[model samples]
Target: MWGSDTDVLNLALAATVAATVAAAGWLAVALARARRAHRRSVDERGWLLERERESAARTAVDEERARIARELHDIVSHKVSLMVVQANAAREVLDAMPQEAEKAMAAVESAGRDTMTELRHLLGLLAPAQDGSEPAPEEAAQLTPQPSLSRLSSLIDRFAFAGLPVEVRISGEPRPLPTGIDTTAYRIVQEALNNALKYGGGRPTEVTVRYADHSLRVEVLNSGPSVLRGDAPAPPQPDGERPDGAGRGLLGLRERVAVYGGDLDARRRLGGGYRVRARIPLERA
Candidate 1:
């Protein structure tokens, strides 16, 4: 009996050792896999971070380009529109008023030179070496004498000189307005005139300013039979949706009007013309 018991005890000891060895091997394989997975996760995280950084850099570049384009559009379009108007006027009177045509041609040359100078200066501002780091307050200060409502008479006279018969009428006493509203109002009229010169059939343009208790109203009406021509941009749609290819000036004006919590309406008149109307609040925004 004692010999049999010893054999059984030895067999049990051997089985116990085999089971312990198998358990330890399984644990070692699991630990190695866990380490490898951790390393791979760390590498993927680094790649994702680098990609995000690259995306951010590209976004910043695109935004800067867009801002520069907006500035160019405002400055170049206004100057170019004046030049076009003057050139047309010079051609029309070249035979009748030799001296007046000479003056109109001179105005066109001056406008072209001024626009080039401003474009060069603005391009330089984007150069890193020139400005070093100017993107905010200094820019506004650098752009001097921003157009305003107070300067309406001078603008109208210039258009008149270009042979676009523009008449001005004012209602309610003119008073001080916030700088933003003043600029916006002027741009509204300026853009309307630009459209008239481009698309209206040499119509009589009327600009009216009506000041009220809490808001200011501006309207530019182009009246003539030529407005019915298909060549002209689709007259402002009453649906408030701008038609494609009408030009960006009106679209930009719409954005500015919305910025100040105002309403803008541009549509064909029932009688046969194009009319632009903007109502901007006078109270502080």
Candidate 2:
């Protein structure tokens, strides 16, 4: 009887030890699985962060490109159009007045050269440097003589040469304006005149410049339907206050003016024409 009792006690002890070992093995397996899941989560987070960084870089590049495009468009398109008109005039009068034609031809060449030089200089600045070197003195010269209201006459002269004369009327004193205002004003007039040339069918156009206490007011009005040229987006119809809700060019101008915090009204006249009026508030640089 004593021997049987001893054997039962040893068997019970052995069973408890085996149960302890099995529980420890299960715990180790669970720990290993948990560690693997944590590693995977960390890797996924890293990948997402890398993707986010790349997306931000792409956005910055695109915005910069858009800014560059807007700056060049007004300058290039308006000048080129005037050049075309002048070239046509020069050709038509070539046989009649050789000297007069020569003068016109010289003007055309000068305008073309100036436009190309400025554009080239701008593009060169935009391009990545070929080597770690600064731009030369001659290269810097191209950027000088930036366009402003002072050069407004030259712009008007170009258009007049094209035979689409704009009557310039001014009310109020002229003072030094900020760079942004200067650029915006010129662009508004440039775009308006360009539209007139494209859609006005050589009708008379007027440009009114009014310098107010708070802002610069400019009006470009033409006597014709506000039609756009060849597949170009139509500008805002004369019916509405917003300048660009109707056309691509005005739309671009709207965005530009908004950037400067200005007010613009473009609509059709009941009598017989289209009008673009912009009041650009004067602000500091």
TM-score of each: 0.63, 0.67
Q: Tell me, by TM-score, which candidate is best.
A: 2
lDDT of 1 by residue, 23-98 (tens): 8888889889999999999999999999999999999898677657755776787779789888988999899998
**What is candidate 1's CA lDDT for residue 1?**
94
Q: What is the lDDT of every predicted structure here?
A: 0.77, 0.75
Query: Candidate 1 regions off by >4 Å?
Result: 1-68, 92-96, 117-143, 226-246
RMSD to the true structure for each prediction, in A, is 7.7, 7.7
Residue 99 lDDT (model 1): 96
Off-target runs (Cα >4 Å) in candidate 2 are: 1-57, 225-247
Candidate 2, 1-285: lDDT as tens digits:
999999999999999988888898998899999989988989998999999999999988886787678767766776776677777778988999888788778878977887887687668758846896877777666564656777788878777767786899988888898887787788778788887876666779999998888888989998765334323333544634233324555666777777778877787665556789988887433
Collision pairs in model 2? 234-247, 235-247, 238-267, 238-268
Clashes of 1: 0
